[model samples]
Target: MARSIFPFLLLFLFTYYYTGVQSHEEGYVTAEISNKGLEFLKDLLIEKAESSLVPLELPKIEKSVKIPIIGSVQMVLSNITIEKIHVTSSTVKTGDTGILIDVSGATANLSMNWKYSYSTWLLPISVSDKGSATVQVEGLDIGLTLSLNTLQGSLKLSLLECGCYVNNISIKLNGGASWLYQRLIDAFEGKISSSVEDAVSKKLKEAIPKLDSVLQSLPKEVSVTDIAELNVTFVDEPELSGSSLDLQINGLFYAKNEVAHSKHYHKMLKASDSCNEADKMVKISLHENVLKSASSVYFEANKMHWMVDEVPDQSLLNTAGWRFIVPQLYKKYPNRDMNLNLSVSSPPIIEVENQRISAIIPLDFVIDILDADELIPVACISMVISSSGSAEISGHALAGNLKLNDFTMSLKWSNIGDFHMHLIQTVMSTMLKTVILPFANLKLSKGLQLPVFHGYELQYAQILCTDSWIVICSDVAPVEQLRLV
Candidate 1:
């Protein structure tokens, strides 16, 4: 999970440019992380720190020292490597400026090959001793604060301040005579400690800018379908409190084939801060505008139109079945096949309220007759379909359900002349119930996707509909433990 989780989680951790507080619901999308996620953050950072420390080659330490008894002694410690690291304590919190992470009371054990050559002050002979040694580093402390800001629609991170300190270091020389051990420790202990402190602090500073760039590289908009894309750009600066961090994003969808948005004007963002504390690492909130935009996209692409020539009852498409209601239509195209063409007059309007979700769809229904091996328009009817929308958390998406409430129908034009409106109403309703509703319900069962990234997918989730938005709570745990809110 760490592969994508680390970058994405850290990206969530840093919330930039908090706006003032408000009361009403305004944001289209909001993500919140509580203290529970902070605990996970600490552990993940520790693992990341350990991984970054290893496979790091420390520069070789070489120096020449002149002693009273010995002429000139040259010492070199090469092939240095960190063998193990233990983080005994760590703390992370959000500050006024940014996020601060402190790791202290840590220990680092290192191993390096040491060689020394000495020329005696009195004798002309030179003695050389070569062996390996281990260094025990104690009381290692690291402190860092990162500054976050949005740069042209991306989050930018920078190391505001960083510090590393090593209280003491002990070096044990192995192959040389016992007397040389004390002399070597006295000369190299201070140098090794300082090098470690400098190296760690420098590496962290250099990595901050590069990691910042990675966060900035995330896509501003996520594609939903061939013709639709969700605007995932930040709508407002992030807000970080003592207990959690929150982000607001433009969650509305748009037609990708054309540069356009729904008629709804974008509103100011307001992250949900009313949720009680929970173990959930993330809470995502989606507004009604998201649904509105989806309807617009489908309508703009002409995807809502359907040429339904087949149905569960084959006789419904033949002129014999409608002869009694529209006698003229049957006389004109006797015993012929028929097709109903359905299309939306305009984009459907969806509104969210206490009693589920209500929608009004204006649709055009046209009848065509097959005559002389050609399809010919026979009649046209206008209708307003009314339905209520419902959603449930199904796996990674919020599955949707639509149930038809009622509809009003009228004749627009008819080549068959006049017909009884009452007789056709009953038949049309049955056709919709047995044919149109089933097809629409089937498609809606697939569900609407939440905001998602390329490499990461949401799991162990539950949803709740409230006020003007829907709340999704999910965990990073295994799927078997999935629970509902």
Candidate 2:
């Protein structure tokens, strides 16, 4: 059962990784699964152990024994099948090198065919009897050490060491003479115990490759948008402690058509105080560079352009709306409709500091005047805006709200003659309050999907912003545990 839990835990634990999370060439993400998290694993493991221990088929065992009078009898036990299993207890512990699992007081019920034959002078012809026997395996114990690492950005699992001890294997014959019981016990007692121990250990070891194969088969990157993909490759090996394990991943946003590269080094990311608390099972930390990667990709794809031809104030799209600000605009084209072509001129520069998610966004707008029912490109304006917000866990991604701060703007060019820089600020202020800020808040509320395991989700999570990194601590439970709760 311990083995069962360890493999599944290894399967989901490090698929999404983070780190001393600095500004890497690419972005970063890391995680810490504390002892609280292991408690959830223990619950899931116990359920799996019940079904996994049965259906174990051991190799056929043949033994040669010299009986008191039968002399030189060959006994073969074939089709040794484990019909039932009971696991009393199992424990999971994190070590300096890797993880350790201990299982004790486990037992199994087995059935096999027992065939024996002996050629003796007492009997003119060789004698043989074929019958069935039931085996009771008791006082079983196993201690295992497993080595978990990242291989080519995928999770890798190896069974480093395993020790299995079985105290007793009592065999009861079904159709045989009275003397056969003691003789069979005297011949097969030690052999049965050894064989049971070996078979049980083998069963536990087989689970590693199967789970490793599952982890390796998962996709390394996920398409987040038409122009970009989320890079989810593990950046480094897990850092193990007495109580928890930390794993880091290269969480960058890669261009859809760009080639990918391997990263071998990163900061050793550890669990923060917010995540190490007893109630929160896992802690996840993300760096600011991750957001920068996304912004860069979207901007490079030329997907940040937005045409604002309609707004709450319909007059904003007409030259009359800007008549007072740009006197010549309305003088030249009276009551003409206008269109504002807005684009993010550059990637937003994001900073995580002092519990705030802040950014500087550069923007450009092209104003088109409708003359004789034909739109005419007039002039363009450039602006820089500042904003701040707090992060939240929205589904699997980090979601947050931002407020635009004070920033200066001026005209980059003008066709209607130069106007005071202060005048343009007033018009932009109205658009930001009535259109841009509210629209941005609404769009950002949905958030983007982060690089997390597809099926698993964090529950009751909390987010904290710090220097160059943000952390979230949360609890997770499988459906079985949810039903129990």
Candidate 3:
């Protein structure tokens, strides 16, 4: 009976103490929950703040919810619009204990026509589409996890066949060389990246020392990983003509310090890939259509940028300048016949430090024109131009054989009469020697000098007197001359 009584007393004491402890615990939870909402709100503000020592203003702290088991804090905010968002201060409440803080807000005066946007730069830099985001905070670091969902603009990267809209955008760069390079490539290739690159490059050139200082502060073995996914609604209509391309990019890399800081860059060109760097880099391809009436004399480099060592020739352009002259001559005058040959070649290389460039033009062809009946004899007309810039022209025509040295001329209607005049003169002179002289009433030696009027005939008729009376008459029947010797 004594032992049982002692056990009963002990049980009563234990029960009283346990009840008291439970009441105290409940009070602590209640107090903690009440204060936790503000704490979590502050954490979100801190995460959004871009600068330290900067205070953020919110209209009100509406509500805060805390989950004791998971140690998560969710706070709803009012009139919470930050001029800028940055990752600044970080605090850890306890070792090995996880705490998550989240803050969210909305504005009544938002313009539906415009996109909402947010961005932050820190160890984990991120930018988002324009809209409201439900930020969930959960991690062991006692920091806020920002989940930003917004209505972002779609990226129209290249002049391709696609119609789409984007509602959100984000960029997260985990430190690495490959990741950094790819981020830079995408950013540069993206709508905003080109401008950003230009600005940065200009600034770096101006502030090399500052850039070096910043680079020095970073890890030498920088490995960057990034996941940039774009949410796009591709518009495809049967009546509309266009292809669709909605894309996301994710990449990783493990590079050494030396490789990370490698000075051997191919100077990332605009649209073309580096030939030498092909093995060291990956490529993303783009597609476009070949329009039926596109300009033929296009520069390949314009499409390929710096990657193309050689540029296509424009001299063969069928629509302009010299080329136009050939085709037009043929098309406009169906009665006249014309032919053309035009070609181009690369020029010799002239090397400069860190650069080598060459150019060539192959403009080689002969053109011949003939009358409708082909009565005119064939002519051999040629133009020869050397890489050294020497030009020679040689030809034969009814105008007589011509040997031209760097000679250039145009054949027009006015010149045609002069050419025919010279030709006619030549043919007439030859025919006179071969035919008219032999049939004329004059005999002449090959080397004899003849009077101009030697071919005239004179006739005199004379009636003879008994003795020798002389009578001369100009008329052939009335002439009288002594006579018949």
Candidate 4:
């Protein structure tokens, strides 16, 4: 019985010790595998940098990883196909430090062609890091992209410690234009450049305090330092359209979880002059029926006002530029103070497809000064604007027939005969004839009578002529008057 008992004890002890050893060894192996993966990532990043149009260099690698495994493993990856590859290196030490990263040889190719009204993104990145003998890491980068819009930014810190200097850490991104453009826009916005430096600077300034908070929360064992500078450049300009944009950005970032650094840039080409001015503010509040594709649009200007304060320098570029016709309004109401209160329920409904515009516009006009005189004030020149068809206008001058709401004016002036006849011909040939012929021809007539005013009989009591323009002398105290010219 003693002999049997001794054998059983020996077997039990052996099994217990072997199981403990295997558990410890498995943990160690998992750590090593993770560290090797980090090294491989670093190497991959170097390769990408070497092949890029704008290469980058980072100072160090800071990372952490966790994995579940069965046996010892060694991973050696020769070549892996990826849409984009990135690398960042940061120093690992005891206190404050700098970070640097080198990025190069990142390539992007459209994997599949599918048109989408609204697009999204998915980012996959692999991370590899080596630290103390007890811990190791292998990681993949994962992120999100939605359409070709833009990205904000993110700073990740691994709260671990180690004296072992990380040599290489690589990150890879794989996606289509939807993901690429958003990332590029974000990175470009992150860098400081002359084109959009102010916008990017403001962003960085706001981010610095958050970065400091991250640094302060790091674990005691980890000492992060040595941040490397990053550079960003684009392969091509991002074409901003409705749903699609093509672009790419290559850059590097280097910093331990305990250290903080950031870069930002903003670039805008063909920017409007109104973008900088603050005094001229425009506020557009339109109903939902304005755009077919949009439910509603509310545009507010911080500096330049399109209608009230000052006309936009390049109003033509605005989406609603045509609605607020600056040139026509300027010429029509020069030196006049008018409150532009015009609203429309819908765009012109063309009864005829190619030649006409039939829109329902609720109009209200206030004219302070007519010609050079400030005494005449026309209030509420309101009318429903409903017109269509195109008319061919020609010639320089040809004044004859004119009519306005039961009122008629004719002319016989010889003092202005020297002016070009082509003006008269062109003015009468087109829509302007409604005003031009009545004003020009009526001025030469012996006398004129205005339509009734407040049921009171008021007629043009006098006529005054000058070398350049014509004026009507009315005796009924001009309260609300409508002059075609």
Top candidate, metric lDDT? 2
Q: Candidate 3, residues 100-170: lDDT per residue as tens digits?
A: 23222311111011121223333253322222322111111112322111111111211111111212233
Give the TM-score (vs. native) of candidate 4: 0.17
Tell me the number of clashing residue pairs for each predicted model.
0, 6, 28, 74
**lDDT for residue 179 in candidate 4, whole number 0-100:** 47
Q: Flag clash pairs in model 2.
A: 17-29, 17-249, 18-29, 18-30, 18-248, 18-249
Better structure of 2 and 3 per lDDT: 2
Q: Each prediction's TM-score against the native?
A: 0.85, 0.83, 0.16, 0.17
Measured with C-alpha atoms, the lDDT of residue 257 in candidate 2 is 74
Q: TM-score: which is higher, 1 or 3? A: 1
> Candidates sorted by lDDT, descending order?
2, 1, 4, 3
TM match of model 2 to true structure? 0.83
Superposed on all Cα atoms, the candidates' RMSDs to the truth, in angstroms, are: 7.1, 7.7, 44.8, 35.6
* Candidate 2 local lDDT, 75-160, one digit each (tens): 88889888887878888898875788788888889888888888998989999888788888888888878787887777787889
Order the numbered candidates by TM-score, best leading: 1, 2, 4, 3
- The whole-model C-alpha lDDT of candidate 3 against the native structure comes to 0.22
- Find the number of clashing residue pairs for candidate 4: 74
